[model samples]
Each structure stands twice: as structure tokens, then as C-alpha cells.
Target chain A: MSRRPPVGVLAMAGVAIGVLGLPLVGLLQRTPWSSLGATLGEAATLEALRVSAVVSLAAAAVSVMLGLPLAWVLARLPFRGRALVRAVVLLPMVLPPVVGGIALFFALGRRGLIGRALQNGFGVDTLIGTTAGAVIAAAFVAMPFFVITAEAGLRQLDPRLESAAATLGAGRWTVLRRITLPLLAPSLAAGATLSWARALGEFGATITFAGNHPGRTRTLPLAIAQANEAGQPEAAIAMSVLLIAVSLVVLVGLRHRWLAPRRRWPEPSQEIPSP
Target chain B: MSIHAEIQATVGGFAIRAAFDAPAGTCTAVVGPNGAGKTTLIHALAGLVALERGKIVLAGQVVDDPARRRRVPPERRPIALHSQHNLLFPHLSVADNVAFGPRCSGLAARAARRRAEEWLEKVGLAEAAGLRPAQLSGGQAQRAGLARAAACQPEVLLLDESLAALDAETRTDVRHLLADLSATRVLITHDPVEARLLADQLLVMETGEIVQAGAPEEVAANPRTPWTAGLLGVNLLSGRAAGTEVALDCGLALTTATPMTGPVLVAFSPAAVTLSTAEPHTSARNTWEAEVGRVQPEGDRVKVFLGPPAPCRVWVTPQAVGELGLEAGSRCWASLKATELTVRQA
Candidate 1:
């Protein structure tokens, strides 16, 4: 609606665009193209990539599956200490990932609460140094994203929908599956994407819980870190390129389909009746 | 054992105690002012709210009763309620929201979807089947809601101010649809006009009590209470007319524009009449010199009802009554403006 911008506005725009675009520009410039082919051919690199994919996908699925019910409970049910329960779910989001890792290690490392029971019953000594451990750690940090977003979706849903479904003869469970879930799908998709992204980026928690084991739990991020530690800058940069390229593709596609524009339902328009 | 039931429940801070016998075909309207618990009564009857101290018995099933500890959850209740809020599901297509209950009732998925399509056609929303609720207009949404309720085909239909949200024109259409699809309908409303247009009987609620209940004509004919008269806007007559003003047999004279040949209603506002103790001559169209039959305090004003035959009434300030030393049998002159008078056809 405005006709023109002031000189200050132009200056601010220049600064903002420069700040926003600098990282992508630098990544493209710094990408080691010649070394990319050789580094990608490395068996360790391919194995690490496979491990990352499996761990991140498993973590995303677990997060969504668990977070949905937790979100519904927090948003819809009334109980004593509900606020406390909600706070517990949200703790991972606020805690530093390293602290999250330490917390995970204490619980699922050999002597932890359920860890002891698992060892006694199933003879599973610990969750550390395994692909499942990396997934558990990744899921721990990623689940909060799903819970918070899904809870917002559940909170915003009108109860009338369920009521209307009932009048048409829907029982509670039927309404939930047929009416409630589909209605909340966009939010669910958004939450799933957030969890996926978070899981893919998991470094500290995976390192602490699963350790860096090639072909087992050493994901792309761990591989890149190991390359850097070994002073193989070329290999690290090549893997970084692949990581950036793939993550960008996943992020863009998920965003375009689920997290993009038009997902935000417009507010009901109020048309003033003519007097 | 009948479809009708006694409904009692408390919601928020309000309590509802009503014995409603919704006959097989008649539409019973629960008409009351705002906050009169009409909707609560409807919800209680629909099993939406738990009873603090009553029961809803329908077709021999004690759906809800606090004392007997018999309560059917809303989902299990045989009755259907089209909620006042036009609650269409925003995410699902129009067809899916309608199909919800049947599928929930254990119908196969295909059968449920078919029933949903049939109801959509019935509500004239078949064209919008693929669209979400956010796509429908107000009336369409309302129709969809009704379609969803009717699709279940429950024994008792409880509409809780269902038409209150629609525009005037759409309301007429929905009301027509409702009348055609009529079952044992318990309609909750605040508008007497809507009540008269839609219902065979009226249940008037005042505060938490049922002040009056009967046919609309009967209730309109002899309003047992003053609130009922005000709500129905009927000429409440308990007096006789003489000349330009009718004197209520209750000792109150009402001025009217039409000259009464015999018995008539001389209607005028309480504000139109000037009350004075002195019988001074004035240009007022009707001047009534009557002894104060009774002086009752109403808010800041006192309603003065004069003697029978010329039974006339006027409202004067409490301060004025005190200053004039007004009491029963005290002589007073009342004057009313001709422009302020209204005549009923009857």
C-alpha cells in the first residue's frame, strides 16, 4: 500500500539481505568440487551417510508417533499436575543438547532406571555405542518439536467438530480417527518435518549416547567431525557439500508440501451487514 | 418410557430443572431470555452435560439421573443435538464430517461414506462435498450441521438455539427444513416470534424456574406473569374500557387513541401519563381523576393502579409519591398525551 520507501529503508534492506544471503553464498564459494567425487567414493563416507539417513528417519517417526498422543493429552485432557507433565515434555527443547545427552546417558547408560530393568530382563546391557542409541538420543531432542507444534494444532481445533461428528453417530474413537487426525494433519506434517530436521542435525546427543562408530552409529555429522579431527579438510568439505545439498532438498520439499504458504488457515472474515 | 424426559442439569453457574415431555410429533420450544438456561436444558436432554440433580429418561432408558446414578455418555445417548455453534470440521471435506457418526456407529467405511453422500444430497450440499468447512457459507454450514444431525436418525432431536446464528432469510429456510424433518424436537430459543413460528408448545423460563408452559396462543392470551407479557408483547388486559381510556378492573386506567365503544384496551406508556395530586385542568387528551387504588413501588417509579371499570395505571417517581403523601385511596389526577396512546385491534 505504501508508495515508496525512505533512504533508511533501502539501507536496512541492503544490510538484511547481505546478512541473510552471506552464509549460502559462502557455502557455494567454499565448496570443494574437485575433492567431492573422491571423498564420496570412500566406503566410510557412504556408510556414514546410510547411518545418518536411518537414524534421522527412525528418530522422526518415533518422535511423531509418541508426540501426537502426548500433545493430545496435554492439550485436551484436564488432570492434576497436567502443567507439570507438559513442562517435562518441553524440557528437552530448552535444555542444551549436550545436557540432553548427559541426561540420556545417565538414564539409558548401563546403570540407569529402565536400563537396569532391560539388562536384568532382556540382557541388553546398554543403549550406548549402537545405532538404536543414536536414534534414541536424536528422538529425545526432536520429540519436543513435534509435541509443541501438535499441541498448538490440537488446542486451536474447535470442539464443535467432534460434537457435530457425534450428532451424526460417531463414537469418540471413530471421531478421533476419521475427523480429528485428518484435520490436524497439516500440523502433524509440520511437526514431523521439524523433528526430522532436528534429528538429522543431532550431533552432541548422538556423540554422547551412541559414540562415533563407523558403519554403525557414526552418521554424516559424526563423520565430518572425525574427518576434521583427523585433519582431512578435503574429505570433510566434500561430505559437508553432500550434507548441505541433501538437507536443502529435504527442507525445501517438505516445506513446499507441508510447511509452506497457504497452510496457515485464514481467520474468518467479518463482513459488516449493511444498515 | 416415552421419548420425552425430565431434564435437570447445572452448567457454569446456572441450574436447569425442567420436566419436558416431547411428544412423538410435536415441537416443544424452550423460550426464555438470555442466561435463562434454555440451551443448558437442551444440552442436558442431549446428555452433553451431567445432571447435578435430575434425570433424562427417553424411551424407557434412564439416560441421566444423578440419584439413580444412571447416565449415558453423550456419545451413547440416543438423542441427537445440532449444537448452536455451527461446528463444521475445518480440515475434513463436507462429506467426511457428515460421515463421521455412521462410521463411528460401526458401519463399514464404504457404507459410512455412502450415507455421508446421501445426507449431503439431502442438505443440498452435495456439490460442496469435496470442500472443507472453511469453504462453506454460514447457511451452508448450518445446513451441513443439520444434515449431520439428521443423518444419525436418532429418536429425539434437540436443537439448541440452532437457528439463532443464521441470517433472517436463511433462518426461514432452515426453519422450514426443520419443520419438514420434524421429530420430537425440543427447540431452545429466546425469541417468542421464532417460538410461535416453530413450536406447538412454549416452555417459559424465568431465572431457574419454569414460569409458564403451554400452547403459544394460550400463553400469549393469558400471560401469567408480567415478564411473559413483556416478552410476548401482548396487550395484557384485566380491566374494562370506558370512553378514550380503559380502566383495568385492577384499578388502573390506560389511555388509548381509539375511542372505546365498549370494552377496550387503552394502551399508553407509563412515561406518557403525568401524575399530580391537584385536579388542575389541562389540555391532555384524557384526564383521569381517580383515587389511588394502590401504590406499589417499582424500581425508582411507583405504579399507581386506579379503581375498576376506569381501571387505569400510571408510573410516577417514588420521590413524587413521597412528596405528594400518596397512599391507597389518595385522590390524584392523571393526564396522558394522545400521541402516546396505541390501540390494539382487539
Candidate 2:
């Protein structure tokens, strides 16, 4: 409604836009157009793409499996130290990624607490320098996003609907599967997409916890870093463009699901005849 | 199925203590003012709210008895609650929402849907089976919700102000449908007419307790509380009676035909009052000069509320109101005959 913004606000807004848009423009300008397809089609680059897809998708799956129950507990349960638990859940988002990686390394590295038990009892070694380790690292850093989004969605739902379902003979599991989850589909999709995006771009944790190895732990971001170190800036920029395109397509494809305002079911009018 | 409950529960520091029973295949209407714990009682019966100390038996099963540490979760209880606002699931079509209960009861999907269609037909919503809940009108949505609850075939059905949000025509239609349902029902409503129409027994609740319970006509004819009298459109006054002369609690005295002693409730119809601009010396034993409060028009009669020392409602014809020049804030003399007053123990 306020079509005429102040001149000062407009000037500051332009600066904010430049801050976000300039990097994309710079990346586009540095892109090597003529050999872009050749760089992307290279065997190493294709392998990195496949690895990135597998790791990020698997991380998303893990996030849902773990985050949903955590979200439900946070949204529906009341207990002492709940805030502390939520803070712990959110710690990885704000904590430095390398710090998270170092923490994971200490907890699950060879001769570490659980790692020592696995080796002694189950003949299993550390979860390091493998695609599974990369997935663990990425999921550790990205799952909080899923938990926060899904918890907020759960908070927005009407608990009375669940009660209505219960009175109509829906047990806990049936209510969750038929009513609660269906109503939460949009939030689940949004959370999964966000965590997937975060996983695809993960660098510090993956490199620190799961050492970069070609065709295994070397995802798109790790491969791009390697290409830069090897002085192939053209290949790095090409892969970077590919990553940006994939992220943009996914975000746009699911725009309506996550970006729209929340909607509640229409209820009957509240007015009643006075007693 | 019959329902017998003696519920004592505390919710948010407010305590509700009530005991009532509905015979098999009968309708019991709980009527009360706002904040009277009517909805809480309904929730307790449906097993949605825990009873701090009480027992609830539906048909013959003991659904809740906190004293014995026995409880039946709402899903396992043989009771369905049609809460205010219908609360139909927004994610499913009308038929699917109705079928949800049957599916949860272990009926196959196809069989559940057929049961849903049958209930929808009974409620006159058969054609809306495939439509979404949001697409239906308010009345249609209410009927659909009723159908959904009834489709489950619960022994006890709880309706919390089911017709309160509907228009007059829709209310009458739903009322008829409620009357036709075979399940034992416990309906919570604030409208006296609604209670009188659909219930075989009426329970009046006040301040989280059932103040009175009896046949609808019996309660209406001799209301125990002023609020109940107001709902029934009758005038009631509390007084201490000494023979035929009753001294009202509001510092007014009235003469009645029957002699009574101790504290009493004097009941009379608003039509028994005659309003005049000048004091009248007639056969009427009670006369008072009071200022008019609110003048509301009912069907063919105008209802007038008189203000303090003896505040009461009086119904008069439009012609009398015109001739007496009655309006709010005007002074008038209201008179009633001694025989018109019915004095009973308070």
C-alpha cells in the first residue's frame, strides 16, 4: 500500500540487493561458456555429481526419520529441560561446521568411545573416509533445519482435530498416519528440501569428518574445492553453476508448498445464542 | 445405550462436579449459561478429559473410573463427540471424513465408505460425498459432521452446541435429525427451546454444577433459579414468605394466593403484569413504581424490563405499549394480581 518508499530506504534496499545478487552475477560472468558442457561431462565431474546426489538425498531421508519424532516431542510434549534439549538440537546450525566435524570425530573416530566398542564387539571400524561418513557429517549439520521447520508446522496444527479423530475411533497411530502427517505434508516437503539443499553444499564437516576421496566422499562442493586447488578455475566455476542451477530449480519447483502463508481449515461461525 | 456419569474434574483451576444419567435410547439436554462447564461435561463423557474422581459407564462398559485407576482412552471408548464447529478434517473429502471412523474401527476401506454413504444419506448429505469439507455450507458441514460421528455406531453420542451456529431452518432440520437418531445422546445447549424440543430430560447447570434436572415441562413450570426462569421467559423472584405476604429479597413485598413459609421462589408469567403511567388501585395486590430498563419486542408482544427495587420482566401488547407511552428510562407503575404469583420453597 505504501507505494512511495523513502529515498533513503530505497537506497539502502538497493545496497542489500547488490550484496546478495553481485556474487551470482560475478559467478555467471566468470563461467566458461564454450567448454561448459565438456567440463561438466568429464568423468570426475560426473562422478562427483552422482556422489553429491546420493549423499544429499540419503541425508534428507535420515533427517526425516530422525527429525520427525524429535519434532513431535518438542511440539507436543511438556517436560523439564525441554528448552535445553531444543538448544542442543539447534546447536549444530550455529556451531562452526568444523567444530561439529571435530566433535563427531572425537565421538565416532577410530579408538573413540562408540568406535572402540564397535571394533571390539562387532568387528566394525570407524565411520570415516566413506560415503556413509559423508552422509553422517552432512545430516548432522542439516537435520536441525528439518526439525525446526517441522516443529513449527506441528505447532500450527489444531490439536482439537486430533481429539475429534480420536472420538471418531482413530487410535494414536491411525491419527498420525491419516490426519497429522497428511496435514503436515507441506512442512515435511519444505523441511526435506531445505536440509537437502544444506547437505548438497556441505564442505567443512564432510572434509573434516569424512576425508575427501575421489569417486567416494568427493561430492560436488569438495570436487570444486579440489579443482580450484588444482588450478582448474574453469572446471570449478562450471560445477558451481551446476550446483546453483540445481538448487534454484528445486527451490522454485516447491515454492508454493513452503513459501505460501499458512492456512487453517474453515470452521463454523463462533456466534451463539446467549443463555 | 444408556450413559451414567458422576464426574468430578479440575481443569485450569476450575472444578466441575456433576452427576447425571440418561436412559437407554433417550435424549438428555444439558442447558446452562456461558462458562457453566457444559462443554467440560461433554468432554469428560467422551473420554477426552480425565476425571479427577468419578466413574462413567456407557451402555454397560466402565469407560472411566479414576478412583479405581481404570481409564479408557477416547479412541477405545464407545462414544463419539460432535464438537462445536463440526471440525471436519480439511484434508479429506466429505465421504472420506465420514469413513475415517469406520476405517479406524477395522472395517475395510470399501465397507467403511459404504457405511459413510448410508449415514450421509440419512443426514441428507448423500450428494456431497465427494466434495471437500471446505466446499460445503455451514449447515451442510454440520450435517456432515453429524453423519461422520453417527457412522461410527458409537453407543453414546455427545453433541456440544451442535445447532448453536446454524440458521433457524437448518437448526430445525438438524434438530429433527437428532430426534431420529437411535443412539443415546447427551446434548449441551443454552437455548431453552432447543432443550425442550429434542430432549426427553433436561438438566440445568450453573457454576459448574447441575442445579436442576427433571422433565423439560416440569423444570420450566417451576424453575429453581432466576437464570433458568429468564431462559424460559418467565419472571422469578426470591423471597422470605410469612403467610400470604412474601417479603422479596430485593426489599419488596408481594401477596400470593397460597400461604408459604421460609425462603421461597415466586414465579409468574410476564404477561400477568399490567403497566400503567399512573398508580392503579385495583384488585391486584402488588403494585410498584419503577423505571423501565430495556424494551425488547418479541413476536406480537413487547417485553419490558423494570429496574431496581423489584426488577422483573413484563410482556404487553404493542397497542398497550403505544397507549402507555412506555420506553426505556421512563417511569411506570407495574401491577399484578395476588393469584398470579406462584410461591414455592427456594
Candidate 3:
């Protein structure tokens, strides 16, 4: 409210700033910018970037398809076990990615419960070590980002607008399609962007559930781990820098996209003389 | 279309039982203090809230009948609601927001836009068609909301303090706009003045029951409850009435123009009471020696509170106040014509 914050708050804010900025500073210091091009020019680095783009985009798409309805249910619908449902939906956000990957393996891997059933009954192509499997693993750890953001958006939605729409003769589905979803565009965009970023950085889950099969399942994060283990630290650092840069650009771009509608739409513009 | 509703429902811990009717083309106003179930009644009509008992018949069709296990959802009902907060869709352009209803009703997009523009021009907001609801001032936004609702052409229009949220200037403008609407209307408000200005029929509620319902002037002149009296800003007295004379509970007897027997409520405006330092020999039907309980300035006039701790109030010019030398402890005679007093069954 005031120009200057209190001394205690300023000191705490400085500590918070350090906590967030120190890691980026460390990354920059170790970036190996001079050899960044040569390091990233390796076939493995380009393959990982390609696989990361494919798998993360797929994961992001899948997360939105599944997360939106769940978000709406959590935010708007009143039903028994809603709290439990929400908790289960958000569990992956808190659970270690490795644990989530293991859980996904149990649920979908060959010889696992549903996986065994599908293999026996339908001779279905297995998800294990496949590109699709990598996408599933990434989504398992990332969908909560989309769901939580979208749920917050749905919660902020004013019910009166929907009521006004209904009274105007919109059926339930029409109101959702015409009014609710259009209004929730900002939140959906932000959520999908977060999900995509999280999926791009997914490593523990992809490595455990999808396996680190180069070109098939080795996303950028998994590739970084492999590069470090294979004694190519410079390549790992270069890829890490690339990943950070790409994510920064995406985040900045998405922020503009997310905020543009609200600002450019000029809601509540300065009170003009009434016409 | 006529709206006949007898609603009996309970929300949370409050019990609501109210019944009223508005014939086609008549504007019926439901007015009461806050939490008196005015909005609940509107919700019931809109089918937003279900009735535990009774039935709602709109245009001779039974929209809600709990006994028959039939209920029409809000969207299916031919009713629209407008509240104080002009809840136009914040994201949509003004034209799109207005076009939304007609489009939903199976109109072609072009036709819907035409209908929206027509209503916009009618509400004097045609120039604002391209603007978002947020771009408009409060008054402009409310006018857009009105156009949006009217464009739906619902059988009944439910207004829940629709004009009450605007600034006085905006309220007057919107109120005039509301008056121009010819749909069968139900206006819910707490302002007695707005009710009188807009309503042909007035229904007064108290603790979720219709305590009074009649023509606005008749209801204002003969308010039976102190809550309504307070809202109407009138002096209300409870007493036993025998013929033209009523003995007030405060030991003051007054004669009224109306001749009614049994218990009655006697109401008169504060401006009707004249205060004098001496017992003036006038043709006033009732005169009482009263003490000035308190003196407070009311704009260009002074409101002299008369007691036994505010049995009545009198408004006189500051000059009259100065001439009469009225103050907190001043003893004075309060007089009024019998014709000014309104007596009604309590």
C-alpha cells in the first residue's frame, strides 16, 4: 500500500529473492556459453530436444483434455466425496515424481493390473518404454498444474453471469459452452502453459516408467541426467541452459497471451460520459 | 402473462411463506426489509429455488407444483431476472452480450445481432455496442443489462432491486427506463418511494410473509406494520378503534377520516403535524401537549422529535423552529386534522 515496505518485511523479501535467484545465478555461472553451440550440436542433444518437444506437447494436450472437466467438477459441482476426489487429483503435485511414476507403472505397465488385463484380453500394444508411455508419465506428474489453475479460474467465475445466461434461455450445455468456457479462457491458457512447462521438465517419472530409451523416451530432463552420468557435463550444462532459455521464453510469451485479453479487452474502461 | 405464485419454502433456518399474483401487463412490487424473502420469492419464480409447497403458475401454465412432482428448470421458464448489480457478461462485447439470449433461443447469428442492436438503440447505448461491459459506466452497464434482459422478451420480468444499486442519478435514469418496459413485472425493493413510483400493486413482506398487498398509495397510506411505517416514514400507532375514533396505546386519542371498528393502525406523515408553543384554538381534530424529545436539523427544516420518547415527529422550517423556540425539553402542542390520519385494519 505504501511506497516503502516495513524493514522486517523488506529483509524477509530479500531472503526470498535470494532463494529464487541463487539457483538461476548458479546455472548461469556454469552455463559454458562459449562451447554452448558445440555441446548442443551433439546428435543426442538434438534428439532429446525433439523428443522433449513431442512428448511435452502431447502430455500438455492430454492433460488439458482430462484436467478441464475435473477442474470444473472440483470448483463448481457439489457432490459427496468431492474433497477426497480433489485430494486424489492433486496428489501428484506433492508426491515425488519417482513415486508417481511407480504408481503409473503399477496401473499401466506390462504385467501390472490393468496392463496385464489389456495385454491378455486385447493384445494391446504396451505403453512401457514407448514414446506414448513417456507422454503418459510426464502427464501423470504435470496434469495437476493444469487442474489446479483451471479450478481456481472456475471458482473466481461469477455465478450471476451464468444465471443471467440461463434466464436468457440458454440450456445448461449452452451456458457452459458459450459463457463459462469463454470466460475461463485466461485460466485455461495459463494452466495449459504450466502443464506444458512441467511436462517438458519431467525426468524422474519418464526415466522410471517410460525408461531412458534414447530417441524413444529420453526427454530433455532425462537426457540431462543421462549426459551427466555419461561424463559429458559440458553437454548437460549446455542443454540445461537451452532448456532454461526455452522455458523462460515460453513463460514470458504465455504470460503476455494470458494477460492480453483481460487488459486489451478494456473491461471497466475509465468512466466515459454515458451515451 | 399472469403470474400466480403461492410459495412456501425454507432456506437455511428461515421459513418463507408468501403468495401474490400479478396479472398480465401489471407491475407488482414486492417490498420489505432486508432478509424478508423478497429475493427468495424472485428466485422461486425464476425456478432457481424450488418450492417445498404450493405452486407457481405463469401464463396459466403450472411451472412448479411440488405436489405433482413437477418443476421447470430456470432456463425453461419464461422469466428473466435483473438485480441491482448489472451483471452483464464481463468478457463479451456489449452487442454480443445482448445478442447472446436471442442466439440461444435459436435465432440466426445475424438476426440475433440485429435484435441486440435494436434493443441497444432503444436503451440509448447503441454507440457502446462495440465496448465490453467493463468499458461502460455503472449507469451504462445497467442500461446494457436492461437491454439484454428485455431482448429476451420473457413472459415475466423479475427485478430484484434492479435500480437500487445505482447512484441516485443513475437510479433515476434506470428507473425511468424500467418504467418504459411493458412486460408483466415483479420488482423487489426496500425503497417505498421506488415502489410507489413504479408499482401498480405493492406487496409488503415481514419475516417471510406478505403482511400487506394492495395499490401502492393505499398501502403507503395504511401501513399496518411498524417496519412498513418506518420504510414509508410515517407515524404509526397501535390502538383499539370504535367507529371513527381510535385510542392510541400511548394514551393519545385521535379521530381519523376513515370509520373502521376493532383494532387499527393509525398512520400520518410527520409533515402533517403542526407544532405550536400555545394551545392554538384551531379546527384540528386532535391536539396534544407534547414535549420536544429531540431537535435535529433536516436540510432546510428541523425535525422536532415529540415524546414520551418519540410518539411522533414534526418537520418545520428553521424559522418556525426559531420562532417557537423548540428544543430538546420544550413543551409544545402538536395538532393535525382528522382527515390527515389514515386508519386501517391491523
Candidate 4:
């Protein structure tokens, strides 16, 4: 604690902080404090907020409904090409969002491969330019976050606990519901929050796949982009501030799990103090 | 219910081939060194580990028979395994942890919790029912794990070193509780005293094989292997006996009470060996000059390990250790009476 760090390291750290903090400072400075309430309470802004909430919540729900089983398979099973399967699952996270939107467009766009069958067989037109398409675009990029977090949680758990449950007469589903899921609550919360946050801020994919239709497919991020293009910088800044606040709350809520040092598995000899 | 198992399984290239039986309401303790496949044997009986080629019959029902291609998964088997770490679920309260088995067995939640409370009361953990497993002490947690296993009313209960992690006093209390349980039990342990106190039958394993199985007193009195001898705090010597004289494999001859004209095993308690600073002219026929290898303190007695020509352990009082000036690398004479040796066919 007494030793001083090198000047070069301190200088670079300051630069890194500035790079991250300056935009937040700029957003706050540009916010129309006097008009904030009016801007936020507008019907258009409220509608976009509703759409954003629905899309993000729906994306998180879909992630949990599908990601848990995939996570279990990846963490517990032994098979050939498992690594390849995981890489494919995580591909959306690293691929450019625009490229993901393009891929979704080809598969689910009007007159596309499955999209054409969906229209002709069910009389349901294209999924593109729809709220459902917006959810798909957001989920494509957000689900990997849930899967990776849940998989890590599963791996960190002691397999012996599951074996103990089984020997105690717990069938597979019972063990999963009563033991695995309860133990995994913290990880599930963190993963779902991350997925929701990512979906709320989705831009390129939603715009390319769902299009920017006000009160329908236009979420808060799309609304903000449209405000900037329509010469309403004050409205855009207010929405950006709202998004930043939401993200900050999420980060604060998850600080212990993400920012703290890694927690070690509990040893049998480690005695936890009774509450 | 009784348990009869002939298990042959290969795990991580280590082969295990063992067979044993525990009659109804009896407890069998398996004692062995590390990597001796004791845990593997219990896992096979609990149906956690599949038997490569074997048969397991619990309560007159075949739970596993590889020849018949019939295998019951662990959840369906009427057996419960209490592992070394207890492994109580951290998220559940102690009572809920205990009730898990009963609930899994189709009891309603309220009824299962009632059964859990009953078992908890029996284990003397009734007061801590609402506390989480992580909040309990090690001994309390172990009791909760035991209650959880027994609450299901399984026919066979497998305990894998369940008491190995407890303090001395807690271990004794838990041992009493274990002895009171009515299920047919198979206990894997490293403690000779625990085996002798709680087990009706003793099984000694080495290198994945059950080397000896019999009454606890019988196995402890005549251990077939050095590992078993060490566990029981005795010296095991292999030799060929002719009449009362036996030629030890380590190039020493000993006079014993029992004699045979073939290969044999001679076991002697360390307490039977008396160490002296000088050669003694005594009635004990087995006396030899040897260098001390290691000296370890066990309770109030000092265990002196003698080196070849007849390597054996000699238990001497601390006062005697001072009188003889015994320590590692010191020379002493160890003398044992002929009647102290137990000779059995190898």
C-alpha cells in the first residue's frame, strides 16, 4: 500500500477511465433537465418504453426456457463435438450484430427458406418487420450470455450433491427442480439480468430485421436513433440517460457477483456462522 | 434386509473385484488403505456406479445383474449412501434436506417434514431443523445427512467414511447413533476402533480386492496383509512354519504356539513386544537385536518400529521409552513370548 505505481501505468489507467467515463459525462451534461419529465412522459416515448420492456423481458424468458437445457448438456455430458456445439451457441455473441441480423433475415425473412413455408402453410406472412422479429434479433445476441453464465454455475456445483440426492431417492426431474435449480438461483438471476440488459440496448439487429415502426417494433434504442436523425437531440439525450440509469442499476445490483473476487467452493471443514 | 453383492467394476483403469454379505440388521465395516476401492464398492451397492460384470441383491431382490442385463438406477434402488462430506444441500433448511428423500419417495410435503423431524429428533438434531445446512456445525450437518438417508427407510444404507471428518467426541456420538439404526449397513472406514465398535463383520480390502472378511475380532486377531495389520496396530509377518518354529520371510525364525508344515502368517500385537536397552535372559523365546526405524506416540504409549532382521512394532510406555533411551536410529532388543504370536495358514 505504501509503494507508488509507475507514472506510465497511472497515466494509461486514467486514459482508460476517461474513455469509459467521458461519454456518460457528456450525456449528463447535454440532458435537457427542464424538459426531461415532459420528454419522457410523451406518448411516443412511453410506447417505445413499453415495446422495449416487452422485447427485453421476452428475450430473457426465451433465454431461460431454452438455455437451461443447453447449459446442462454442455456442462454434464461427455460426447464428441461438444466444444464445437458450444462454440456455435456462443457465435452470436462475438459476431457483428448486423451480420447476425443478416443471417436471421435469410432464414426468417419474407420468401426466405422456412419463412416462405411459414407463410404458405399457415397464412402467416413474414416475421420480418414484426415485434416477434425484434425479439428474435435481440435473443440471438443475448441468449449466449445466459447460457455461458448458467453453464459456469452448473460446472462450479459439486456433482456429489446430485449423487447424494439420487441415492436419497430423488428422480432426475425432482433433483433438477428441488436441488439443481434452487442452487442455481443466483446464477440464473445474473444471467437473466444480463440478457435483458443486452436486449434492451439492441440496435443493429432490431433495426435491420424488425425495422423502425413507432409503437410496434420501435424500442427505446430505435426511438433514440430516430430522434437523433429527426433533429430532436434533447429527446435522444433523455432516452440515453434513461438507458444509462437502467444499466447502472443493473451493474450495482450485480456488483457482488461480477466485480468481487472469485468465490471458492465450500470445503467440508469450513463452518459457516449461524445466523 | 440383507445385502449380497458380487461387484466387478473398472474405473479409471483401476479394477475392483470384491464380494461380501451383510445379514439383516447387521453392520459390516470395510477397512482399507487409500485407493483400496472401498468407496467404489459402496458406490456399486448404492447403484451410483455401474458394475461391469457382477450381481447385487438387496433384500432378496436383484438390483443389478449384468449377465441378465438388468440394472436399477440409483434413484430406484432401495439403498441410500451417506458420503464422507455429508453433502447436505446448502440452499435447503436442515429439515428440508432430511425430508428430501421422503418427498422423493412420494410422501406429501407435510408428512415428509414430519418424518424428517422424527429422524432429526432421533439423531438429536431436532432443534436445528429450521437452520440451513451451511449454518450448522460439521457434526450437526453430518447428522442431518444421516437422517436424510435413513428417513427414506431404505433397506440398505451405505456409509462412506461418514464419520471420518468429525472430532473425537462427535465421532463417538455419531457412532452410537449409527449402531442404533436398524438398516443393514455397509460402512467404509479407516479407523480400527470404529470398525470394532460398530461393525458385526469386518472386511479388509487392498488393491481393489477384499483380502479378508470375518468377524471383527477374528480379522483383527489374525490380519492377512500388512495394511490390515497396520490398521489394527499389530505386526504381520509371513513365514513357513514347521512344528513350533517358523522361518520368517524377512530371514528370522520365531517360536509360536500354533504350528503348521506350510506357508503361514504370524500376527502379534505391539503391546506383546517388550523393548530393552540390553539383551535380556527371559522366558520369551523370540528376541532379536534391531535398530529403531521410527518412533510414534499413540495416546500414552510410544510405538517403536524395529528394523530388520525381524521388523515389528513394539508399544512401550513413555516411561519405558525414557528408561530404555529409545529413539529413531537407536539399537534395542525386542522380545516377544511364544504365546503372544497368532499363526494362521497363509
Best by lDDT: 2
For model 2, what TM-score does chain A reach?
0.93
lDDT tens digits, residue span B1-346, model 3: 9999999988787888998888898899988888998888888899888899999999999999999999998899988777667789887899999998889878999999999999898777888898888778767777788788888888799887776546666677677877877789998887778889999999998899999999998877878788888777788989889888998888888888888989888888989999888998999988889888889996688888898633877788999988999988889988899999878788
**Complex DockQ per candidate:** 0.24, 0.52, 0.58, 0.52
lDDT of candidate 3 over A151-269, digit per residue (tens): 99999999988887888888999998888999888899899999999999998888889998989998888888888899988888889899989988987788675655446464443
lDDT of 1 by residue, B1-346 (tens): 2465566677887777777676676788887778888777777777667888766778777878789888787788777788777677776677877876676677887998899898788666777777777767777777777777776766788887777667777677667877876467888876777888888889998776788899997777656665676666543454455666666656656666667656544344556678787875777766767778889886677887766335556678888888887899888777767667655433
Ranking by DockQ: 3, 4, 2, 1
Instruction: Decide which is better by TM-score, 2 or 4.
Output: 2
Name the regions of candidate 3 deviating beyond 4 angstroms: A1-35, A38-42, A254-271, B121-127, B166-176, B242-245, B255-262, B293-304, B315-319, B325-329
| TM-score for chain B considered on its own, for each of the candidates | 0.68, 0.92, 0.87, 0.93
> In terms of docking quality, how is candidate 4 classified?
medium
- How much is B12 displaced in model 3, in angstroms? 3.2
* lDDT value, residue A105 of candidate 4: 88
Model 4 global lDDT (CA atoms, 0 to 1): 0.89
- In model 4, the Cα lDDT at residue A165 comes to 95
Task: Put the candidates in lDDT order, highest first.
Answer: 2, 4, 3, 1
Alpha-carbon TM-score of each model against the true structure: 0.78, 0.94, 0.90, 0.93
Superposed Cα deviation of residue B237, candidate 2 (Å): 0.9
Flag regions of model 4 displaced more than 4 Å.
A1-8, A261-275, B107-130
How many steric overlaps are in each model, in order? 15, 0, 1, 0
Supply candidate 3's per-residue lDDT for B25.
83
